[model samples]
Target: MKFTCEKSILQEGISTAQKAVTGKSTMPILNGILIKAKNNEITLIGSDIDLSIETKIKAEIIEEGNIVIDARLFGEIIRKLPNDVVSINTIENNSIEILCQKSRFTLIHMNGEDFPLLPSINENMIFSVPQRILRNMIKSTIFATAQDETRPILTGVLFEINNNNLNLVALDGYRLAVRSENLSTDNVISAVIPGKTLSEVSKILEEDDENVNITFTPNHILFNLGYTKIISRLLEGEFIRYNSIIPEEYNLKVIAKRGDLLHCIERASLMAKDGNTNLIKLSMEEENMIITSNSQLGMVREELNIILQGQSLQIAFNSKYLIDVLKIMEEEEIVMEFSSSVSPCVIRNKEINNCTYLVLPVRLLNS
Candidate 1:
């Protein structure tokens, strides 16, 4: 394969595709990028069987051919080269030549035929949402996905579509984050997409109103973004029946300034961090909420004025869990509903129901 293109264009395509490269020593072909030159376009693809990212860039195709080159080495070379037109050509002995402003290099290229074929989804279940909306949905819930591999299904976020609403649900054993958005689709679809794959797609998605078309298959999910597309295998197995776990009603409801509560817990967690459990207690009274933490080194006590309703109660939780939810929330004020100190605390936007976060509290020992 031979092609000449601007450095910036080539660099971006390589960088995006490189993210999907899984250099499994056992399969060297998986580490190489498949490059095809035709129709005055250069298509670059990188894949690891499970996740694949492909991008197309306009380039002058001199000799129409295809080759697979080492993703890491090719990316490093193109990135460091001068910002000028780059020319590449395949030579004898299965090697390729690279030339730029004044630099030159030659590397052995792998046979493109050996690369695994990327799964194709044709005329599948197609739906789309604004890029910004999808990006925001992923960021708000991805953090709650379980990091441990104990339950593989829990490591992926659930993409559920029912009626005209889309919900992204993620849960680690201790916390749950659910972000919802309204769309114009009436199709019901459910898929468990890996968090790692979704995170990469989020990086490539532009924060604009442009829609990203999504195609779903029984075994795969594809995110098609005009010039680029991401394909990932669906995680097998059933996800937790989340709807049954959350309480329908709470004994107490408290409305407080999100920033004020977040800051108070942050300061108190400093002391709580030193203890085995990152515990913080919230003592809610008729007119005031007291935040306190006890540790081996010291204790911290802070107070915030809150609007209380229903009843007054006290609850204890891990400071980190609350901090995660508060940091991602964009609203000025938040609503917290508590069934009891032992039950989970439900946090939601004060004025809207776009997002719901549930945090399981750490049991407090009687002293």
Candidate 2:
């Protein structure tokens, strides 16, 4: 294959496709990028069996052919090249030459025919969502996915779309997160996307209002942009019935500024981290809330003004769990609800119910 393209354009396409290349693959070809030059366009593909990414960029094609080049080496070369057009040509003896300005290098190339093919997904079961919205949805819930593989399904995010509403749900047994958004389609989709795949997809998606097309199959999901596409395998199993686990009402509710509550917990977490259990206690009095943490080395107390309703309560929780949710929240104020100290703590946006967070409190011996 022979092609000439601007360095920036080539670098972006290479970087995007390289996301799927894992160097640990047993098949050496899987660690390289499959490059196809034809029709004034250069196509780059990277895959690691379960995930694949393909991207295309316009280039001046002198000869239409295909070759596989090392993804890491090609990316580094293109990125370091001067701000000029780069030329790549297949040389004799299974090698390719790269040239830009005064720099030139030759590298061994693999036959593109040996590369695995990406799955073909039909367009029947498809939906369109804005890129920015999809990115936000992934960010809001991906953190809650289970890190351990004891239950494989919990390591993925549950995507459910029905009745013109899309919901993303994730839980790690200890905490749960749900993010919902309105849709303009009538199609229904239910699938569990691996958290690792969503994490990579979010990085490629631009924070823009432009739509990204999504197509789902029984065993795989496809994300199709105009110039790029991502294909990932779907996890096979039934997800937990999350709806039944979440409580519908609470006997105690506390409304406080998000920043104030977050800062208080963070300060208390210092002492909690010094302790064995990393526990922080909260005392909800009539008009204010007090947070305290104690360790062998020291102890700390923080007080914040809050509006409490229903009943006075005291609770304990893992400081890191609360911090995880608080750092990502985009609201000025937050609402915390509880039925009892042993019950799960529910958090929500001050104005909307579109987002929900549930953190199981650490049982205090004194409670």
Candidate number achieving the greatest TM-score relative to the actual structure: 2
Error of 2 at 179 (Å): 0.6
Candidate 1 residue lDDT tens string, 1-367: 7899999999999999988986774688989999999999999999988899999999999999989999999999999999999999999999999999789999999988888899978945678899999999999999999999999999999999997999999999999999999878879988999999999889999999999999889999999998999999999998898988788899899999999999999998998887458889999999799999988787899999999997778788888999999999999999999998899999999998899999998887771
Task: Give the C-alpha miss distance for residue 19 in model 1, angstroms.
Answer: 1.1
Candidate 2 Cα outliers beyond 4 Å, as residue runs: none
Q: Give the TM-score of candidate 1.
A: 0.98
Cα error, residue 362 of model 2, in Å, equals: 0.6
Candidate-wise lDDT, in order: 0.92, 0.93
> lDDT at 35 for candidate 2?
98
lDDT of 1: 0.92
Q: Which residue ranges in model 1 land beyond 4 Å of their true spot?
A: none
Per residue, candidate 2 scores C-alpha lDDT tens digits across 171-277 of 99999999999987888888999999999999999999988898899999999988999999999999988989899999999999999899999999999987367
